[model samples]
Target: MVNGPSTQMAFVEVDCLPTHRDLVVATLCRVPEIISIEVSARGRDLLLTVVTHDWTALSDLVLSRLQIDGILRHRTSLVTDIHLEASDWRLDALNRAQTLEVARIEVHSATVPSTVTPADTALIDLISHDGRIGFAELARLTQRNASTVRRQFTRLTACGIMKFRCEVSQESSRWPISCTWFCRVEPGHVAETVRILRGIPETRGCFSTTGESNFMFIGWARSVTDLLRIEKEVAQSQPTLRFLDSAVAFATPKRIGWFLDQSGCATGEVVVPTFSTPVSKKH
Candidate 1:
């Protein structure tokens, strides 16, 4: 373990009320130090690789802001940090998280394949700590074929169940991808708030977790200032929400999707079926 105020990416687990799920995720999106926000089976949550010195802040975020609306229970764990991203560990962890439950795979298991298992849990910790890896690096991490990695990624995203996009590093790129930040809302209005948020074209994912914040939200913006303006507008628009604090991210450390699991990681463990596209290619 990296001693002192610094951390080595530990998985944080939060048990949230199903209704408050979306609100929790939407709130965490803007936190600057948070590396990534994805959904999974450990229950709906925003798994973040918090900066080593900033881990305490994460606790405050979950408690003060994330403890409202529909949230019921909150738990935290220190699963091993994998030093990778969600997309990179998708297939490998899926096989491992599942293996913990049974001696063999069965067709009738009720669990969705997308939730992060203990095996992937370790990878999640790593991505939280280091979300800046590539396919070649990930291939080496799991010792898998590059073709297999590519195929799994394409299949997962094409199915519309999950996806991973290139995120430019902070200040390195003139134009960064669109995004959002959040503040906690009163526990009663989470559902209403989410309905409004999802109505926006840019909002991508949301979740509820432990700490001062009760929610985390992420979305695309045309520019940095554009995202800031939107966050401000949201505060004014939702009076019942009781906004507490917020942050805006320039880069992420890790994330997960269908190639790794399902839409749950991005959207609070909501079951999303595989994407079905009309065939346009010649047979």
Candidate 2:
């Protein structure tokens, strides 16, 4: 059995200085098992998903280190996860899912049957880490041939089931990091508006929903003013949309397509450190 990361996801309640939230997240990224972590609205809480040898060890780490951060207030719930092990067949099936049936727009439906295998999934997970991992590294990790891995990568990307991009980490620039603005768009005109939204290079991710915000999207802005320009462009492009609310995330504890959690299991890369206590001081 792979026995890798087959545990449940968790939502941890946390409170901290609005100024220090990002710092806290950057710190938590050290946890080895956590696949993803993100900040939420209202007080302060971080959504975390991690793998465990046993769920109990996972719980102790959460309470002992994360909750005691002095800067954080921690409340955790291990969400029920019925999904089984990750498989290439499952992913290929998802990609093969019909267009109208596909839940997200980024997932364009396919006509051909899948050619992906378990080795391919493993390889993609590897290169996805640095966003620039070479084929030889992936083959070594998954024990597959280099040429085979390259073919799988091309097919997977060509199938739209995976993606990779140059990371714009804060270390690269002092300018404000980019963020996406999710909107509670009124019903109707959903499809029409998405087309307009994608026209902009700043746009990175987009999806429709049935919640108060029916459509969600991410875009990059160099500054507050640039952010507004993107918004204005959105307004002008989709005049029919009756916008309800918008959330401008100054800092993202998590990215839109971050399959990797705090830990780097998605890529079988580095293990992100973790604290098993509250994240911030709850005032």
Candidate 3:
């Protein structure tokens, strides 16, 4: 089991030839640490969510096993905080209010059980494919009654084991220019810098990670001009922040365990592989 709330997480971007996509996914899914995998719409890269008790071993595994010849490049960022934008719900007012309401929930120390029951696993498998599935549908899929399934769903959400969010596609969103920013901030200013980034309307997600450039954020733009403008505004507003690099995301094939189709809709299919053996500690 994970060491409770202190479990460390990392987001990795893997760039590879299109031909190696499935191979890459298959290889990564076999690794016990990877929790989620996403493919870009363009199909050239993948995003992975990894959980580990030891960052050093996890880094070694990623660098050795995941960086095959066909793989062009890969970048890993440690996640300190994650902010999800609810663009699909179109409930900006409600979302903003709920965001504040949930502010009391600690970010860095949220505990996710390292082990789960079969029922819990089934529920997670079903919901990951379709976060909006009706209770009746979930009951049928999980071989449980509607009431039981509903209770399980509620419990999972309440415990931070699961979350339901709107996934918007670049082609459909008003601000379609999606990019990830790798940033460096003054050691003392990391918290303030992340706060400012989260407050930006275009910021879809932001995180603090371990590395030379210790921060990363995802932002959207309506056009190249808008993207540049946003970048300039952020730079001006937070003088302590420095951009190390940025990468444009052309696609997101899988998110939070759901496999996405060409139109960027969740296919209600789970592609992330599971391991029968418990995760072993390298340290």
- Runs off by more than 4 Å, candidate 3: 1-7, 13-69, 72-75, 80-115, 261-269, 272-283
TM-score of 3: 0.70
RMSD of each: 17.7, 11.8, 5.9
Q: Among these predicted structures, which one has the highest lDDT?
A: 3
Instruction: Write down the worst ten-residue block by lDDT for model 3.
Output: 82-91
Q: What TM-score would every model get versus the actual structure?
A: 0.35, 0.51, 0.70
lDDT of 2 by residue, 149-185 (tens): 8877666655544543333443233334344344665
Local distance difference test, candidate 3: 0.65
Worst 10 residues of 2 by lDDT: 82-91
Top candidate when judged by TM-score against the true structure: 3
How are the candidates ranked when ordered by TM-score, highest leading?
3, 2, 1
For candidate 1, give the lDDT of residue 54: 37
* Two-way TM-score contest, 1 vs 3, winner: 3
* Evaluation by TM-score, superior candidate among 2 and 3: 3
Clashing pairs in 3: 39-253, 40-251, 41-251, 41-252
